[model samples]
Target: MARLEVRQSWLGDVLGLSQSVVSKRLRGLLPFTGPELLLIASAMNISLGELLGGIVNEKNPHPVDGGSSGVAGGRLDLPTSRL
Candidate 1:
């Protein structure tokens, strides 16, 4: 959030959570839910893919492993289900 000058307390307010909860999530003590991620992305004015570091432009389709999975490590890859 340093890049955008977003503070934890402000993010907590945006997500309707406490600063401690946001801190825990930021420190990896707790995981961020899908809805929470969406809210964070919306607040940051970025797409969910970009927030998750999973955006893959067509020009550089094969970045991490010579595939276009979008997700670099293939760890947070979501299933192709329509919303």
Candidate 2:
């Protein structure tokens, strides 16, 4: 059996972006756009949850319709209490 490897260049190809862009995103110089994230999730043959890095929280319900609240895949954790 051969080893399956994932590389930045491969990811770049999957995202239709240059390797430098992928590197920049990896290094936090740029943010991963929503489409890029979806493509990456597809290319890796992984679920969105796995691609999201296990940030699911059953206790905290996220806002719908693109609300700027709740934990965004571990990016943040905001208080859900409406005061």
Q: What's the residue-level lDDT of 54 in candidate 2?
A: 40
> Could you give candidate 1's per-residue lDDT for residues 1-83 as a string of tens digits?
66677788888999899999777776555666666767878999988767666445565443344433323443333222221
Using Cα atoms with residue i matched to residue i, what is each candidate's TM-score against the true structure?
0.63, 0.61
Considering every candidate listed, which one attains the maximal lDDT?
1
Model 2: worst 10 consecutive residues (lDDT sum): 74-83
Tens digits of per-residue lDDT for model 2 on 1-83? 01236667777788788988767666555666555666766877876555555444465343222323223431422121321
Each model's RMSD to truth, in Å? 10.4, 10.5
lDDT of 1: 0.62
RMSD of 2: 10.5
Q: Flag regions of model 1 displaced more than 4 Å.
A: 54-83
With candidate 2 superimposed using the best TM-score fit, by how many Å does residue 36's alpha carbon deviate from the native?
1.0
